[model samples]
Target: MLIGVFAASLAFQAGSAFAESYQGLLKKGYTVGKMSQGKSGSLGWVLTGKDGKQFCKSKVSLAVVDKKTLVSILASGRMVKVDRATFEAGIGGPDPSLPLLSDLKAGRVGPQHVGACTPLRG
Candidate 1:
């Protein structure tokens, strides 16, 4: 019985119930804020690429997963969850904690950077 209860709890916690919607997260600033690649703000934001070209033109937003974790989303239909502590400490950023690479490699990018640049500018 104890084991069953513990497993149930684990499964529940693994899901997005621990996460919040983009706007819902913006409302609660429990160590979370707006992150944008272009002149940071809550809305009217843009995501730029390393080549200085437009990547994702989105109204990106951020939400706190925990005291040290954050979830970032873009209206362009991309999302990435990152570790706020690491990101702020200059260590930075998750994509469901796993990534799938292809046989043919194009560009080399660290897996930690999943979505556009939502640097938690909030």
Candidate 2:
């Protein structure tokens, strides 16, 4: 019984995390711009809002398992939330603990706060 409960907990965690992807962002009216690699080896992305004004730009760390893409914010210098003109300007802050998941094969993204991009500037 203990083993079964542990397995269930793991499954639950996976389900909760396996959400949010490039396609998912598009469906939600977000435009994911080109992905660039910074000198620190982090992936940078500029996702614009539906109206094309506000955006979320941050250096991210990505992990690919099978067809799943797990991305975490590697925010280390001047984070922008949603109020900026240039896409890439600042760079000087501490790292964040936000994680987002995306499934490449199934094209699914998820558990509620998947689209959250707070405390970041454009």
Candidate 3:
């Protein structure tokens, strides 16, 4: 019965975590952009959000079996799981080279030449 209790507790915790992560993603305006299946059967997702002025993108890698309850790794090397508050808070920010969400909100980073994600070949 101890094993059963432990399993029940784990399920509850996972459910709570999933809920938090889902809410956070929604609050941060992330929508599913693309999905791909990895070789190991894990799922990969690219999350995209736009402020109507600029775009924010993140990639998440997770297991398909526990898609909802898994944490994803961002391209920025940040580990993000499905906890809405933390994800939202963590995602919508700025970098020194790129315009931050806060700056965009405040009308700081105008619709100008934001740098490209890739460098010019020529």
Candidate 4:
């Protein structure tokens, strides 16, 4: 019984220790690069810092919706359904009018306005 309790405690600690959110890391100056595949065949974005240093080696994947690929998840885990066109705008681009990574960090687009961003455990 004591062993069981110890193991449960360890499991909880391990999960919490590594459960850093995508937004949390982005707030720390991490930039999301192009999508890439991991050794396990899973897709995720490469995270880099302002200094050009790679952050997570394995990377994290995002899931916008259950069946639909377009969706946004907030830190609270609230899923907001969005359309493809809207999702593209959230992506930003050469158009300065749209929100970019810098705007994301600057709070131009609220968390809800952003698309799905799930960080994969490397």
Candidate 5:
């Protein structure tokens, strides 16, 4: 019984460490690059940061209500239900007048957006 408990605790600790690693990647600023379509039409996305660094990326089965909204889970297990307007506004371009989503959907990947995430100053 003690051995089982120790193994379980180790598994939990490893899981937590994995989650922290993904969070650390996000804190470094990663942008969504490619979204792969699933067998059921669901989607998966890949996020890349500046200097070609890979951040947290995920694939999820999504249910779309409107043509403009997507509800899915992030790689970190965070539930994200985003609409076109919100997505566009939230992922604004360097000029704020342009949005990265528009370019992404149009097959154009741009530079990483500044201040996109909490700046890591350590």
Candidate 6:
């Protein structure tokens, strides 16, 4: 009985640990380059800072659920779902998404707007 309780506790911890990742905090504009498949077979984008300098030379992958693609930071695996307006504007250009990111960080976003985001390993 004690073992079962301990197992449940461990599972819960693991689940909640990844519930929110550090990626969700990034609000700065990133220039996402062309999409390409990484060596690991994950489809991702090459991101860069607004200055046109190299940001993440490696490809960053996004998880899409129910036609909604999740956005996340490459360094951390935190994720958030933005409206179509936000996504279209932010996906490839310099767009201020601080308010949207803030809403996600504060958990003010509704369940319908929340999606899964996982960082790639490579």
**Top-lDDT structure, candidate number:** 4
Q: Where is model 1 poorest over a 10-residue stretch in terms of lDDT?
A: 99-108
Model 2, 81: alpha-carbon shift in Å? 34
Which parts of model 5 have CA positions greater than 4 angstroms off? Answer: 20-23, 29-31, 38-41, 48-122
* TM-score, per-candidate, Cα-based: 0.24, 0.25, 0.22, 0.35, 0.33, 0.24
How many angstroms is residue 72 displaced in model 6 relative to the true structure, after the best TM-score fit? 22
The sequence of per-residue lDDT tens digits that candidate 5 reaches over residues 4-71 is 99999999887554433334555667555554433333333344565353332232223333547655
Q: What's the best-to-worst order under lDDT? A: 4, 5, 6, 2, 1, 3
Instruction: Please write out the lDDT profile of model 1 over residues 57-83, one tens digit for every residue.
Output: 232255446566665655543457777
Q: Which lDDT tens digits does candidate 6 get at residues 50-83? A: 4332222222323323333446544334345545
Whole-model lDDT per candidate = 0.39, 0.39, 0.36, 0.45, 0.43, 0.40
lDDT of 3 by residue, 19-120 (tens): 223224446685542333333333333333442211222222321223123344444434455543444467683223333323322323222412111111
Clashes of 1: 4
Residue-level lDDT tens digits of model 4 in 1-122 = 99999999999898676545457667878766654443444433455654343323322122333223443433433445556455556776222233233333333343333333434433
The model with the greater TM-score, 2 or 4, is 4
Which residue segments of model 4 deviate by more than 4 Å? 48-122
RMSD, one per candidate, in order: 18.1, 16.2, 20.4, 10.8, 11.1, 13.9
Please report the candidate that would top TM-score against the real structure: 4
lDDT of 2 by residue, 1-122 (tens): 99999999999888555434444556678754454333444334445564342222342333233222223335442223431212113434322333332331132322322323322233
Provide the lowest-lDDT 10-residue window in model 4: 53-62
> What is the TM-score of candidate 2?
0.25
Error of 6 at 76 (Å): 25
Q: Per model, how many backbone clashes are there?
A: 4, 12, 7, 2, 0, 0
